[model samples]
Target: MKVIIVGYGRMGKEVEAICAQRKHTIVAKVDPVCGDAPALTKELADQADVAIEFALPESAYDNVKLYTELDLPAVCGTTGWYDRVDEFRNLVTQSSIGYLYGSNFSIGAHLFFKLVARAAQLINPFPEYDIMGFEAHHNRKKDSPSGTALSIANIILENVERKKTILTDKCDHSINESELHFASLRGGHIPGIHKVIIDSEADTIEVSHSARNRGGLALGAVLASEWLKDKKGFFNIDDFISERLKYTQMI
Candidate 1:
């Protein structure tokens, strides 16, 4: 497979390494600082089978737009610019190009989302059980509470009837029982840590996912790229995971 890396930063380098290990060819890189190519023109995009984007949030929309315009399949792992997701969805639908985006491209984290959802569903009817979410990342991380944490919270809100909203800010007074409080901590060099706590007066249950490094995320992104090489239309990690599970069931 011929691949173009859209960002040459830490995650981009990791994607490059994984793609090489998987025997895929790197046709070009499109970062201003460490880009192997000058710019992300249609000519450069035409050289690769697909593009994997891990660029900054400010540039992610433009990068995806260019790839879709060129009819190039793209797998994007950038977060924090999701307000325009509806716009990109329309673009991908109209252009009929393949595009996959995820907040965190870790297979384990995806599974963790499912597990958290199921837990929330099982705990929904129990009024005594209260749920709260907490996530911590490296200080250099851009978004507070992290996108992965938000994904986890969204799943819970969808499944648990009581959690109608998500609150990320620090709570000065007592938190409402109907609101799901999400606390974020940024410090040190922590790769990532997310926890969903379910508590009652009698018992407490906690489910967590902790990443030791970026390998899981990079591998998942490369895997998504390979899966998206020949496909068309917009997708997310859930679609990828669902397809894989179907394949596994058939086997």
Candidate 2:
């Protein structure tokens, strides 16, 4: 695969290493700083089959937009810009380019999401079980709760009958029964750690996932880029997971 790497930061560096190991060529890199390719010219993009975007939340929109405008397939790992996903969805609809995104691309994290989802469904029948969770990341991380944490929270909210909303901030007073309190901790050199706690008067159940490093995410991005090279549509990681499951079942 010929690739264009957007954002040459820590994650981008890892992506570069993974691409080389996977034998994928990087055609261009686009970043305000650290970008060697200088600009994402149509000529540069033309040489690449897909672009892997790992930019900051603030600039992610434009980075992905450039790919769509140039008819380049994109696999995005950036978060905090999903509020404007509808805009890009429309762009992808008008074009033949493929776009896939995920909050955390680690396969373990994807499995963790499923475990938490199933646990929520099982506990939904018993009113005694109450769900709450927290996520911790490196101090340099900008997003507080983390997009992965929010994704996990949404799974709980969807499967559990009682969890109607998520509270990502502090609650000085008593918490509401309908609210699921998901806290965030930022410190140390932690890559990522997410935990979902199901508690009751009798006992407690915990489901969690800890990312050892950024390598898993980088590898997943490259793998998704490979899978997305010929596909056309706006998709999320779940679609990737679903396809993998289908193939597994077939073989």
Candidate 3:
């Protein structure tokens, strides 16, 4: 498969390495740097089977929009610009192109989402348990309370009825019972870390996922690109995981 990498930063470089290791051809590398292919164009889009984007938040929407407009399938790993997701979905549907986006592309992190949901459901009836979330990432990470942290919070809120709201800021006073407090810390070059803590007077339970490196994320993006090549319309990691499980059942 011919792949076009839409960002040439850290994530994009990792994706390029993995794609090459997996024997996929890289048709182009687009970045904000001048002279890096000048600009993404229709002719370039036609040369690739799919495009994988890990660009900046400010440019992610434009990159995906260009891909869909060119009738190219796209797998986006960029976060922080999801406010326009509805608009992107509408465009994908109208253009009849495939699109998949995820907050965190690590397959393990995706599974962790389900684990957190189940944990929330199991503890739903136990008023003794109070839940809180904490996330830490590299200092350079643009978004605080990272997208993955928000995803985890949303899943917890869905299964745990008690948590009606998410608070991402530090609280000097007591937090409301209906609120789930999320603390975000940024420090040295850590890849990412997320934890959900459920506590009571007796004991405390914690569920967490720590990234060792960017390889998991990069590999997942490549896998998503492969799954999206011949498909159309809007989709997400859940759709990809469901299809994989179905195929596994057949085997």
- Give a tens-digit lDDT track for model 1, residues 1-251: 99989888999999999998999999998888979885688887778899898989999778777887788899999876889999889889888689999877899998888789889989989999999989999989887978778888899899988889899999887888778999999999999999999999999999999999998999999999888878999999778988997888831
Worst 10 residues of 1 by lDDT: 242-251
Show where candidate 1 strays beyond 4 Å: 249-251
Question: How does candidate 2 fare on TM-score?
Answer: 0.89
CA lDDT, every model vs. true structure: 0.89, 0.88, 0.88
Worst 10 residues of 3 by lDDT: 30-39
lDDT of 2: 0.88
TM-scores for candidates 1 onward, in order: 0.90, 0.89, 0.89
Which 10 consecutive residues of model 2 have the lowest summed lDDT?
242-251
For candidate 2, lDDT tens digit of each residue in 88-110?
68887788899999877887898
The better candidate by lDDT, 1 or 2, is 1
